[model samples]
Target chain A: MRLSYPANVKIILVPCTGKVDVMHLLQAIQRGADGVYCVGCLEGTCHYNQGNLRCRERVERVREILQEIGLEPDRVRMYNLSSGEAPTFVAYAREMTELIRRLGPNPLKHSKPSIRLEEAA
Target chain B: MIVAKRKPFEEILQMIAGHRKVLIAGCGTCVAVCLAGGEKEVAVLAAEIDMARRLKNQPIELGQTTLERQCDREYLAQLDDRAASYEAIVSLACGVGIQFLAERFPTIPVYPGVDTCGLAVNQDVGWYEERCRSCGRCVLDRTGGICPVTLCAKGLYNGPCGGTNRGFCEIDPEQPCAWYAIYERLKGQGRLERIRAITPVQEWRDTVPRTLLQPGYRKPEKAKS
Candidate 1:
């Protein structure tokens, strides 16, 4: 389908949503992507059986870590839908983009270069 | 393996609140397998702390390194070249590893990021249950494979304290009575007679710090003096 989604919703294609690691989401927010979310195949219908489920777990893990770090957990999320639902995909994209706008920019939008602790000592 | 649990994130943040730079060291042995401290956990923590401090406007420069084992001097030597650069260290190792890191880096403040739980068995991912207390005594021959010292609420050596309710301990209804399990196991193995014999009262080890010297590692009697 030649449907349009928010252009700001930069897409990163993985072999499977299960391929997304916890670090990937954190790194995005740390590097100033105000928000990050994963769109995986609907539950129980992942291409690789449990890949999408695993993706959900990782997404939840990142969300929890965000809360623990005193950040908005909603900044990270996971959505599932069938491949044929292009409109739903667009809807989710718009929804997430709106959510991020409401949450404002990631506080870490401007990170100083990370240096070794020893260098500081 | 010695199991450990990570301390609260707020506690960790407080431990380094005054420091502008710190190192989070990880251990790759027991704590790693238990998922409390490992390469992945270290990176996740580092990222969390980085973002957290930034948000607080008290940004910190954090460094992370996962070693093969932090308890051994040889492995810790890997950080010798750069250990002096940090004002503080948050060790994501067991209590022993934390001590070892402290001993190795005496000048810098060393804080424990995890609480050493004790010996445990990994039943599954993110699940670890304590199984031993390392009391410096082994009595498995009489108690069957179930450890009375650990499983029992009172750490009884002989038998249950009569608080067992339907095979579960009265102290914790969910936990099966340690002695009851021992008796059932002994009965299955046709070794019920072992439970009948009273285990001699063990001498209290009042020594503050216990040291064990392997036969080959100990000095000869003549040289011991």
Candidate 2:
């Protein structure tokens, strides 16, 4: 089944979302990605039993880290859908793109006026 | 193994606030296993620090390295050539490793990235419960292999107190009463009589620096001058 999602959403495929590490999410934002979202298998239906569940925890951790560092936690998210749910997958992709659009660009992307950390503090 | 947790990023960011170049250090042994200051953690932290500093418009240059064990002089020597060059070093090891790193490179300011908690048992992924307190004495023989000092909220030596409600400690309803668990364990082992014997009060004195002299090691006397 052919379906289309936002062209702006660059996909990075993993064998299973469980392989997505916390650093992967953080690095994406650090390198100027406006947002990052992990789409794992439906909660209990993960083929690997707990792969998707593990991914969910890592996603939540990254979200908390983002929030703690003074950034919007909403920039990162976790969505679960089954293999048969192509329409749901497209919907999630579009929804993620829309959310990121509203959040504007990542704060790290554009440089602000030069100021010492002491002054910035 | 030693357990530790990363410090709040805001506090870590402030630790090297004035520094333009920094080295983020990590330990591979206990911290790595505990998911604190391992190689992956160093990379994640370096990325975070880089992004945080850049957002503030005072971007910092971050470098990182993870040693096998930061507590040992042999492993700390791996950073010998590079440790002295950084403006500040952020160590993600436990307190012992941090002190060792600081001692090795006295001129550079060493800041801790993680708080060392205690010896723990990994109950599950990302879940660690304290198992030992390093009280310098072992009394597991009397307590049926359970440490009363660590498991008992009151650190009582005799047995469970009035606060041992059912099988849980009163301090935290979720925590199991140490004495109750000990009793159950002894009963299972057919050594229930162990609980009846009075365990003498422990001596908590520390007259000399608590240093261990393992076999085949240099003595602490420094060759008697």
Candidate 3:
């Protein structure tokens, strides 16, 4: 059987994970993802010399924000994996799926009003 | 250019603690140039607040949006409708943007996420220093065009006072005395004689309680209708 991940976990494929801006990372959280992770080229191996570095910085910054917002910073994570790193990719997927599973369903799922209420309180 | 720095995220969070619905507004101008308040900043703030609320199970409705220029009413008009939805607004723009947001969203409380420091020019990437004070009355035509309001430390309009030492300022050893530089610059230009003319004290109103005006940006009567 082909290995698949949790149906609820949405994987976004970016050309280079380094291209992810801090806002985009935050936007993922705002859009109601249970957990978000990025897979990018290893340090110093990015297609763009420092794109991965920049993306890593963004991820780290988001982690700090998550903590301030009273969430576990672990909710958003970044990993360095070249295109050929299939095992690493699958491992990351599994890890994120497990984390999301523990986090349970997204608070905003199918309930905009309730999400807003929850957010307001 | 205005120089500013991001207030610590925690400080910002504390400022908007009571508001259930919040908007993070970024200025696309001066603060953006410094990488403090811009679209990226607004997004980061919104996300941080969201995550914080989620973790606490307190949940705060947060929105992210940016304006091209916070000082211009034309650009600020964009926030009109959305401003009503949020209980409070956090501005990442310079002091101007924060004030503009307040003016536009009078009913909704507006907060600043960055401290608007004095006017400055980038000394290098990620570095900036005080430059202009926009003192309304400009005297750059004389004194070799250097601004005294920001540079002189004393805002002196005359020759270097007794405090200057070896052409450096007493206030800061790294800074060359403003009048000393002005003297040298004007002497080289053969305009040193102009220093004898005392400039009237710069009016205080021009430099503070800052105001912004955008010509011809008001919606026409037809548009308003």
Each prediction's Cα lDDT score? 0.88, 0.86, 0.76
Candidate ranking under lDDT, highest first, comes to 1, 2, 3
Candidate 2 per-residue lDDT, tens place, A10-96, comes to 889999998999989987888778999999988888888999988988889888888776689999999999888999999999999
What TM-scores do the predictions have?
Answer: 0.94, 0.89, 0.69
Native contacts, share recovered per candidate: 0.56, 0.31, 0.35
Candidate 1's residue-wise lDDT over B23-125, tens digit each?
Answer: 9999999999999999888888888888888888888888888888988888888888787888899999999999988998899999999999999998989
Candidate 3 residues lying further than 4 Å off, grouped into runs, are A1-18, A24-60, A63-67, A70-121, B123-125, B203-225
Best TM-score among the predictions, by candidate number: 1
Candidate 2: residue B224 lDDT (0-100): 32
Interface Cα RMSD in Å, per prediction: 4.5, 10.2, 8.1
Q: Is the docking of candidate 1 incorrect, acceptable, medium or high quality?
A: medium
> lDDT tens digits, residues B1-225, model 2?
999999989899999999998988888899999999998888888877887778777888777888888888888887777766679999999999999899989999999999999999999877999999888778898788999999999898898899999899998999999999999999999999999888777776664557877889877655331
Q: Which ten residues in a row have the lowest lDDT in candidate 3 chain B?
A: B216-225
Model 2 lDDT at residue B124: 86
List DockQ for all candidates. Answer: 0.50, 0.27, 0.21
